[model samples]
Target chain A: MGGEFEGVVRPRRMRRSRRGQALVEFAVVLPLFLFCLLGALDAGLWAVQTSAEVSAVEQAAMVASSAGSSPTSETAPDAHAVLTSISGRLRSALFGTTIKSWCTTNASGDCAPDATQRCPTTPAEVQDVDGPRVVVVCVSEADPPACATPPPGQVAPYPPGCEDSPMITVRVVGFVASFVPPGFGPGASGFELPANISATTHTLRFAP
Target chain B: MRRRRRRGDDAQAVLETALVIPILLFLVCNFIAVMVQVTVQEQLNSATALAAQSRFQAPENAIDPSGTRCCGAPGMSLATAGLPTGCRYAAETFYGTMTTYTGLLHWLRATLCTSGGDSGNAAIPPMQPVAYAGSPSNAEVSCDIGSIKPGGTVIPGYVDRALNPPAGLNVVTCSASASLDFADTPLAWGVFWTPTLHAQAEALPPPFRQ
Candidate 1:
């Protein structure tokens, strides 16, 4: 009887020990596994958000530049009021959307310049850095309605027969906040993700 | 005794499953998110190119009847004293192309972003125009021939002597920029900052021989 009891008790003890060992191993590996999984998830999420930010800015900039949407509305009526409405619309669509006007210097100094006036020869000659800078001009409507001379740093090559014409320009910019988790991602100590997510655009102003 | 050992094995299996399943889920979700992002970016690029191309399609005579001859409508023309027919209304073209864009994901494109997105048709940020080139300076005409018409010669009538635009004039080019945000994600707790992505596209107007 003693031998029989000993056999049963010994097996039970062995089983208990094996189960305990497995539990210990699982506990030890679980945290590390969890960390890696979460990290990957974070990276993926960051990428998705980045793409979304870009999409948002592009859409906003295009709409702002297009004629059908140029700041003037039945409700807003006037240019300033239309501009105000535009600002509100952009802000609502994006986290922080700002419109920077790039215009030739006007008599009052940053209001829309005389349409026929030429752009300054150099960027440094520009008096107000606050006003948005003109990257390129399209002569969609010059007296001859052609393309403007390319600016200092203009990239797209000008087309032919397109003379300098009356034209409007629009610029849009928006910011995307960083996604790094504090003390975890690239900006653990407050460093931001290296990629610049600010999007800027230049387009022909559709509004006359 | 045998049953006792089997019970111990079952306990171990349960723990392993609990640990491994979540990791697998995390990885799978991440992969899906990344793929979605890539697709979105590609669509944006196509939209920009299409929009630029459409700008050139505006009938050469298309003009805002109310536009002033000097700057707005009836673009200044050397052929005539005032705004001429067949002049392009660039703003309208740009807006039309962008609003009708159907490249984006169905969910993303809730409405055409018209009127700076303030018209309440849909809520979306506007697309910004970044750069454009049309007509060439006399210097550029000689310096950058290929850029203007590829293989075409400068037409005698294309030159605007009054404006005195340099040679090799006549091409429409446009550049557009945009931004997007990821509004929701599963990693919110583990992430502190939201990510913003930016993209830009440039295109030359459809080629036209002067």
Candidate 2:
């Protein structure tokens, strides 16, 4: 009976081999498990950061909208003051972030720095989807006046006053570094997220 | 010896599972909890902002269109007429908007099934009146609007009074708080508690006096 069983299975060697197999399985699963764990951690942090940024931008927009714009400077210039107030509201780590605001004829303007689209040359009558209008904040893809430094002779790109400013675009641009590797497991610290997170809000200059 | 070795191999598998399972569960459950926390926080932020903005659209409690009479003239003592009309309207608007926003948040809570630990099955409480740290007179939704001065006390009027200040500009602010209860989550067994989340926002009324 013993001889027949021995031929069928080598028990001692099988036991040791089985232990080796289990170790091999664990080793194989460990990296995949850790990769997923770390990835989730990274993504969760990113979502939180992005929401914070959007809220900050929205708050800034509300401030600007309430104050409305004016050619005449008040205690603080409306646009600058609004941006500064937003900066004050955001976390100190976001100090490098820039706030841009502008007015234009349509939503064809880029409100970010280094934009090239032209502001309306004159207060030409522009159609408003809701009402007749002369100006609208051109934050769509149009050049933001706050971002540009026009030549001395050229008209100021962002004209002042609520009527001169039919719409206001407030944009906040900043970077958020991940707490974990950008694309994969924990050790890929060399990766830096390529693009920044930005939030843009357009509010009618309702304060006239 | 062979039987003993086989038994040891079985024990090894059990031991490895025992060591790994709890750690894995901890990580997974915590991940879920954090995700829910972020979602709730984001919802709170949006609600707070919209509520603040709504305060501007409220009818200006004004006898005049310019809104000059809303508060007495500059440096004139506090208006004896009780809270300014714009202030009261802003408070009512802010509170109403908060209720609407909070109701909207129900969808989020349903999807996530998380709430402040104290709320249990109930919805988060509505916005409450909070005075600036030191100024008891300056209620969260009060006509005594102003900037924060040296201590936490809020100075009762706009410094830039140049814009003729909007009606809702009377220092009307909103704040809300709720806890993210991990007790109801899969992490309940592991995480005994969650920190409370809070949001506060300030806005001047819309500049349109009418």
Model 2 chain A scores worst on lDDT over the 10 consecutive residues at A126-135
lDDT of 2 by residue, B1-210 (tens): 777977897789779878877777677666756665675566456555554554344334331122222322223322222333333233333332222123212221200000111111113232222232322221222222343434545443332232233221334454555555555444686565565677776655443533
Error of 1 at A207 (Å): 8.8
lDDT digits (tens) for residues B64-153 of candidate 1: 122212122223232222322222233333333233112222222211111110111212232232112222111010000012233453
Error of 1 at A176 (Å): 5.4
Model 1 alpha-carbon drift over 4 Å, by segment: A1-25, A32-52, A63-180, A186-202, A205-208, B1-210
Give lDDT tens digits, candidate 1, residues A49-124. 4444345434443433333324342111212322333444444433322333334435654435244644333322
* C-alpha lDDT (0 to 100) for residue B154 of candidate 2: 49
Q: Against the true structure, whose TM-score is highest?
A: 2
True contacts kept of each: 0.00, 0.10
User: How good is the docking of model 1, as DockQ?
Assistant: 0.02
Candidate 2: pairs in clash:
A104-A136, A108-A142, A109-A141, A109-A142, A110-A141, A110-A142, A110-A143, B116-B179, B145-B170, B145-B171
DockQ leader: 2
Docking class of 1: incorrect
In terms of lDDT, the best-performing candidate is: 2
